[model samples]
Target: MRRRAWLHVAVLAALVAAATPFTAGAAASAAGRSSTSASPTLMAPVTRTFTFNGTPQSYTVPAGAVVTITADGAGGATINCTYTGKGGTGGRVVTTLPATSAPTTYTLTVGGSGGKGCTPSHSGGAGGYNGGGRGGPVLVDGTGFDGGGGGGASSVAANGQLLVVAAGGGGSGGVVLGGPPTGNGGDGGPDGTAGTAGGARPNAGVGGGGGGGGSTS
Candidate 1:
């Protein structure tokens, strides 16, 4: 009985000795693998705005990202020819981008407002134009009136693709005559073309109509 007890004690000690190295090594391995950083949490949505027309911008969409864009047209300058040129239109767009294996860079642009101005007299220098500003006629030689300019359109681009567009406003008409006539300015549509200028009656005075605004496709 005493010999058997001694054998059992020796066997138990050998087994514990063998298991001790493995248990210590596993604990050390687990400790080494642990991270210092905390778990990830949700973040708020992102947004950006463009006030000028036709300005180019760039951004990247991350995993599980949603995007929205809004574009507004500039108002046409008020004038007193026979009529005034109208203001430009505004628009909005929304889209979702899928996750990419790697971060993808996207090209973006926002449209600007057209310029507005007039000639000095029956004959004068050229006025400014761009984006939404359509060229109006420059009356000269005869005793006629001046004219107004049209507004410009806007555009939104994502990943080099056109997503949305807001149309431009129209220009007003110009007229000069012998009798007294009302001079009114043209206002732009919400998302459409502009109105024509107030014209002369029965071949009375000298003047021309304003141009229409642009659109997105």
Candidate 2:
């Protein structure tokens, strides 16, 4: 009976030791899983590029798309376009505001032409004459901002033959900022000749002096 009791006690001790290792291993596995699940995740930023009219463009925008427009070459013209998305404005010349947005169509128009010679006496300079300028009707668009007017000729009696002849003056160049059109008309050749009219405002050229009358002894 004593031997049997001792044997039972030894078996119980062996069982306890075996169970302890399983519990410890389970705890260690659970700790490893918990640490793996709690770790932080990292993501990379998104980037994209857009090309328009041979120009390369790029943006680091969020998950979305953007529209773009541009103008090239010379022509009295303005751009027109349509936009869709938040903060959109309809069909109009975009002079100010968001730099990213732009027009699709480039519409150009000729500017008014310079005035012509009415008669030697009434002839105006080449550019921006007859109400000519940036806003003139006959003027070509994008020709230039401010153009000079032609010079006037000396008055003569009807059917009267005059020997003195004068040439009209050339127009002045236009400025960057929309300034006045028309330059001073060249002075008549030598004597008593009328001077050409100057541009509207901002730009004004010196008038041509009248040509001198036929020499008198």
Candidate 3:
């Protein structure tokens, strides 16, 4: 009888030992899963905001000079810009001049018409010498719901002698309830107009076309 009891106790001890490992393994697996789920994901940095006035303005760049401009977008959209340059003998002429080593002064201007029904949150492109004008807003269901056109280019001569001018086109306006639901505004005219405004819908609006940039001797 004593031997039988001892044999039974040994069998129970063995079973308990065998079960302990499985329980420990299950707990470890659960912990690992939890740790993986709790990990955080990294993301890229956000772009900074910029803004510019849609007015006809002028700026001067000395000979062998360079400049950069920035603008902010409205309705969670990005802004765009264009550049042009002209040179002359006296008082900066709008001629087909090339970049030079000496410093010369050239004037820059920016202007654009009113956008149609689209929001007025867009900035006009920069202009020099003879930049083209911007286009009108996009048509929304024939409701004239679009952005305004960019300013036209100037017809000035470089070096006060030869006529060297570059004009950009205006940008198209945005649309709503159109195809694909997430309608966007038309892009700015190439090499002329200012940046176009973004559509007001949930998705991002089309970017405005940049004006043509040039340099004169």
Candidate 4:
């Protein structure tokens, strides 16, 4: 089986407003009262990154500030026999969350890579964190052929509302006896569709399912 490169990244940036104190009166007295001026100050932007550990992560943003969120899905696993069928790559998604009157908390879920199957097994491996699909398994006579697992999806939410989602890739299919394996797995959802797994074999191992896509609403 051929080797594949896996890369997952997430970056967030937020801009907020600030105020600066004014010196004593800058203008001469007007009609027995001193005049003063006030201006809004722009604060520096804040950037952050999150890592995945089979659990959800959280971040807080200041009130009255706009926040941008970006997420990447994980890749699927592959199966190797005489011939190698490579897994699909992960997908990416970007969206923004509007500012609120009060400070807001957002939750992020990173995608996980699919399980692998280099040897024959009774069942396929489990899917990664998030929404990755599981690989297919086959039973022939007294032996079982296992398929690779699917990748997981990456997601972001705030106030219980889903803000953005990135789809994961599909897993590779099982191999046939004494020969090459089936076709390779499908790519992740480009726009918002789910990932697709490779072809399945009759009375043999089946391909894994792809991860589901996310929303930007």
Candidate 5:
């Protein structure tokens, strides 16, 4: 009886010793898994703004990043000299950009406001930055009436490819002696329309229409 009890106790001890390593290994693996799951990698969000500077600007972004782009074209210039027509407003655009797998660089072209003052008689206004058109001039009773300049277009590009564009507004035109009410300026892109011409009066210079804004597809 004594021998049998000793044999039973030795077997039980051996079993416990064999199971100890497996239980400890399982507990260690579970702890490692918990630690790994507690911490994760995250990406930060980015935001930027662009404005007219008469030159192209550059921006860089991370790979697989989502981007939102908004652009606005410049407004046409007005003539403070006389009771001339008012300039048109610029166009606005908002869009979402596609994600790129590699780090990307984008080029920005901001629109410039139209120039003021042409000069002398029958002298037209200068074009705005980017793609704005020139303004029309007039002469009435041998007196010169200078015209206002057109606004410029804004655009964005990626890898030398054009992504989007917002068109500019048309400039104000001059008046005629008995001309049609005052001349009206053209609206900006999307609706890109031309300005109205001045009315005809004997011995009075006839005014020309302002150029239309550029359009995008």
Candidate 6:
């Protein structure tokens, strides 16, 4: 996501537009391993991690099992002297949501990492867990967590409920020539949270990392 010579004002908007909410499941995890059948609660919780590189994953929740999910977004590439691409947003922690119908299997999709832009371009930030895919991190739940990643969304839905969580911040451009008040740094979305702008040569570099969206880490 390097700054192009003729970048339109909407480029940033496009990136923001691509963002979406995340989601997760109800039951917790199993202690040592995944359980087939159980009571109402799991003896130990089960944990899952997604990288968003391969096919989506599938999981089944028995009558009484607890599962914990963790994921990261893909990171952006580094640029030469152009604007920095936005980092992947952070992922969220999700828990207990009523399913459409009491069934077992669940499908999960981890976010993939962002790719580098061409010359004068920079790399995108990485995605976070189940919430923001790290441009490239993760998602889930009406009420989940916010791991550290760039380009994440505010909230997500899973099993029919919304999983509220943190989103990632935007990247900055090479540097500012004149005065724009705000530097080349891209602003954070949903809440107007601002990113640090860049300075002139020698001082010019990529944008600072955006604040985490309720990150657990």
> Best-fitting candidate, measured by TM-score?
4
Model 6, 134: alpha-carbon shift in Å? 14
**Model 1: residues with Cα > 4 Å off, grouped in runs:** 1-41, 80-108, 120-133, 139-142, 177-205
Measured against the true structure, the TM-scores of the candidates, in listed sequence, are 0.56, 0.19, 0.26, 0.75, 0.69, 0.37
lDDT (CA) per prediction: 0.39, 0.21, 0.26, 0.61, 0.56, 0.29
Model 1, residue 150: displacement in angstroms?
Answer: 1.9
For candidate 1, the TM-score is 0.56
Select the stronger candidate by lDDT from 4 and 6. 4
Candidate with better TM-score, 1 vs 4: 4
lDDT at residue 62 of model 4 (Cα atoms): 67
| Model 2 global lDDT (CA atoms, 0 to 1) | 0.21
Which lDDT tens digits does candidate 4 get at residues 54-148? 88888776666677766667777766655577777777766666665678877878778778755565566567677666676655532434567
Give per-residue CA lDDT, model 1, range 26-143, as digits (tens): 6667778643334333345556544442455566655434444444444433344443433323222233433334444455443333333355254221221224444344444454
Clashing residue pairs in candidate 4 are: 132-151, 132-152
The per-prediction CA RMSD against the true structure, in angstroms, equals: 22.7, 35.4, 30.0, 4.8, 22.9, 18.6
* Per-residue lDDT of model 6, residues 73-185, tens digit only: 22322223333323323333333443223334555444332222222213223332323222211121211111213333333234644332323333222222231221222
List the pairs of residues colliding in candidate 5. none
Which candidate has the top score in lDDT? Answer: 4
Higher-TM-score candidate of 1 and 3: 1
For candidate 6, the lDDT comes to 0.29
